[model samples]
Structure formats: C-alpha cells, structure tokens
Target: MDQISGVQQYHQLFGTKVYDADTAFEFLTIAVFQAGMSWKVAASKIPVFKQVFANFDYHKIAMFDEPDLEAIESNSNMIQNGRKIRSVLQNAKAAVQLEPEFNNLADYFWSFKPDKSEEGDRDTIGAVVAKDMKKRGFEFVGPTTMGLLLVGMGIIERRPNA
Candidate 1:
C-alpha cells in the first residue's frame, strides 16, 4: 500500500536503520527464505520468523534443538519449508563462530561488501562470499542468494549522488 514493491516496503521499514548482529541475522534469515520466491512472500513472513527465532539472536538460535526447529516446521504462518527453517539454526551457529573473529555477526557479514568497482559484477562477488560462507558451515548461501542479500543490505546499491 505504501510502496511499489514488497522489497520497497521492506526498505521503508529498514533501509535507514542500521542493524546490530541480531537484526542482521533476521534479515539474512528472510534473505534465505527469499531465494526462489517473491519478496512479498518472504516479507510477509518476517514477523512470524522474528517471533519464532527469538528475535534472531545468534546466542539463542544457535542453541535451538530439534524440538525448536520442529516447532517452526509446524508453524502454519511461516513459509514452513523444513530446510530453510532448519538452516536458521545452522546459520546462527555459523554466525556465532564468526563473532570472535569480527566484533559481531553484522561486522562479519558487512566485511564482505563488494568494492565499488566490483559492484557491477555482483555474481562474482557473491560467488566469492558464498564460497567462504559454505566453508564456514553456513547453508543455503548460494552465489545468487548472496548477491541478492548484498542488494537487500544496500551494500551493492548504485550510488545515489552520482
């Protein structure tokens, strides 16, 4: 109602708000869900995900047992694909491992921002980052997905003032 696209609506909520690690996790969770689907579907499910995943705190989600994931699996409000739901925990766990290396999960994710020159070829940057994420034990982080995530984060955006 307020914007042209679901993604634009998403940006209206978050574009100017710089998030900490917890919120970054939430965004990434939705980003993963957005893969192979419309932004509308993924955006609609965010509130549900925030409630289910303890506001995307890596400390909490990383500790999620089978029962927790199962609960999400059974939640009718969610997109409910078992793999994506399960990956929330897996990805949280991976993010936890990166916290010590960087200041937090957000810093680690932000560190992969493609250089301005490299922005024109996001697929290449995404491939590189995706490989590293896979090496770090994250799931559902394919190159195309990573590229889209960068776009969502505004890290790969075209310069506005230019």
Candidate 2:
C-alpha cells in the first residue's frame, strides 16, 4: 500500500478517533509486533493478521490456548515471535481484566493524556503505566512501548515539525 492509504488503513483499523475495544486491541497487537520491525513491513502484514487473528478481538484472543499460539507462531505471515505472540494473548487477558477498572481501554489510556495539548509527555506517565501494566501481568510493555501507545491512542500528539 502507498503511504497515504497505509496511514488511512491504520487509522481506520486502529481507531484514530475512537477509543473502542477494536482500536485498543489493534494498537496493542500492532505495537507489540512492531517492536523490532519496520512499520512498513508490519503495516503490510495487517491484512494477514486481521484474517488470521480474528480481527484482533481481544476477548477471543484471550481464550487462545498454547496450540493456537503455536499455530500462529509457526505461521510465516506473522511476526513469528513466541514471546510477542504470548504477549498478544496475555495482553488480551489484561484487556479483559481492565474492563472493570476502566470503562474501556480508551478510558484507561486517555486518563494519562497530558495536561497541555501542545506539550508532550512520556517519561513520567510512561514509566507509571508500564510499571502498572507489568504488575497486572502484561508483558512486552516497557516505557518505550507505553510512549508509543500513548501516541497511537492520541493521548499525545507527535510534533512532526519539531
């Protein structure tokens, strides 16, 4: 896909304006998969992921067992990292678990939105969120990951001109 369409596809897929479950799962799964890969490569695989992973439905993904994980791990079309795949599964569980604490992932994520719109924050909130996430049994999440998630969640906007 071209750059424009890629951005559009990603925005539509991950809910650029909406903070619903579909968007949340897409953000987490895509972010985790993009850990060490180029965004181009990861973005290109979005279709395959959607088809194979049941459109990133966290509730369904949370129910995936070891066999399901192994099958996905061996699939050449996917990122093929056992750890990341497991994070996908575990994070789904975390998503399910977080439903009660917050209305939804959007509510939880937006709670960390910076006070100043023009100014961006990462260090403090990222660290706190990452620490809490780890404590909640979420894996593959670090300060860096949390920072990126915040950006994806539109909690913090990246200044392209900066």
For TM-score, the strongest prediction is: 1
| Error in Å for residue 29 of model 1 | 0.3
Give the clashing pairs for model 2.
Answer: none
Q: Indicate the residue-level lDDT of 144 in model 2.
A: 80
Off-target runs (Cα >4 Å) in candidate 2 are 1-8, 11-15
Candidate 1 lDDT over residue span 51-150, tens digit each: 8989778889999998888888999888869988888889999999996789887787678776667767777877888899999999988898777666
Instruction: Tell me the RMSD of model 1 versus the true structure.
Output: 3.6
Worst 10 residues of 1 by lDDT: 1-10
Best by lDDT: 1
How does each model score on lDDT? 0.77, 0.74
1-162, model 2: which lDDT tens digit per residue? 334544457765442444777676777777778788775566667776776677888888889998988888888878777888888889889988987888876677787777884346665677877898889888877788687777767677754662
Per-candidate clashes come to 0, 0
